[model samples]
Target: MMLMAAVLQAAVVQPAPGMLVERRLAEAIPLAVGDTVRVRALAGSAQPRPFVVAGVFEREADPNRIARNDYEVRLHLPDLEALLPTHDRVDRFAIVLAPGARADPAARWIESVAFGTRAYGSAALAEETSATFRVVSRFHDAIGIVTILASAIFLLCVMVIRVDERKRDMGTLRLIGVSRGTVFRAVVLEAIGIAVVGSVAGAGLGVVVTRIVNAHYARVYDTTLRFALVTPRIVLIAALLGLALGTIAGVLAAWRLVRVAPQKLGER
Candidate 1:
């Protein structure tokens, strides 16, 4: 009862007129605590109102805000009203429900009370807003598939050339009584080694590129949001995929060499 009473009393009371400025806005305007700033609403012809800066805050690092990057000022309801010509009117409201409260019911109740207003759950809002990202993700997936296909084809070609170059040596080994299985294993092992080395080099390059990209973004945006990330899991997946492709390519190339007569392989 005491806690509820205190909360009610606090709700009934209004704090002194002051606004919190966004970090970007504060830095751009060079605002500090206790500094006075003149602000005017863009919607109305009201003259600029003097306001004391209570605090400077960093905006939440969110995907939605990254595109807009708008400056913001948070002030009391009365102070906001005084700055603009409008009175007792609000464009939007954010409601926080208690634990175990259903969003649909709360949203319905809010819409019932507030005519001409639409309320959406977090999931619905995300689904509606994330269409662009979904499209971009699909495009990236398509590009990745094409890139993998190209890389596999290129690897096959490289293996074929390498095997062809060593044909005479392989023929000599076979003449010296080296078994077909031994030669096949040698080629496969070479492919596996190439895949391992390539995967490591690629991972290193990816990490370095990600760092460069993130640094550029940080310098430009003054935010810590990273544009690219190279995690261990991703690196491991690439290595495994490389190994699989390399093994397959090696098998095909080795088969071409082994099926021919040793005498034919010795020819230029």
Candidate 2:
């Protein structure tokens, strides 16, 4: 959540008043923290002011991830005296609201002001701020849904086959004075074993894949892109989901098999 908030803050880039904003350029001078830099004015002013550098950032400028041009640079913000020399123009501001303050009310208040007639909020602000978080959340959702559906289909098939294969065995057990409850429990245990194995293997594969991708990307770009690494919480949820799905399939299969009479089993 901290990472999400930090990324959202970066995504919402609104320059302060009279600051000249420049995109990352090719063969640009690299910047570090506390490095003072200067930016050419958009108005083509003769002199450039030494602006104290706050920070530097690197990110893919592409909206779509497939085609990407990676760029890195520092943003140079001009001071007040620097603003006095150039044609004064303040385009936008990135406002950080206090925790207790409602963004909607603040936006409305800004709109009520005479100068705030052009103020816009809500959808536009969200688009600018929450792009990365929304994309990543959707991606994770799709992966999780697919994993559950695939597991369900696989478990269903396994349960159906196991029931069919053990029909004669189940019939014999019933004739030998075993209750239907015993048969149900045995079937549930078998399903539990299958679910445990599958969940463990799948979790291991996910971890390996994440590590490989992370290493590859870092080697190529030297940039840290946060991956959705599996945690204990995620693993626990996956296990619970898998066990539930498997038990349901197994019980349904076992119930249908138990309904068959011993005589019917002999005919089969």
Candidate 1 regions with alpha-carbon error over 4 angstroms = 1-16
Residue-by-residue lDDT tens digits, candidate 1, 138-244? 99899989988888898889889999999999999999999999999899888878878888898899999999999998888777687788998999899998999
Best by lDDT: 1
Best by TM-score: 1
lDDT digits (tens) for residues 6-124 of candidate 2: 99999897643322222343225554445556654455455665655555444543334422644433343445535445544556656777778887778778678656355556568
TM-scores for all candidates: the values are: 0.86, 0.63
When summed lDDT is taken over every stretch of 10 residues in candidate 2, the lowest stretch is: 18-27
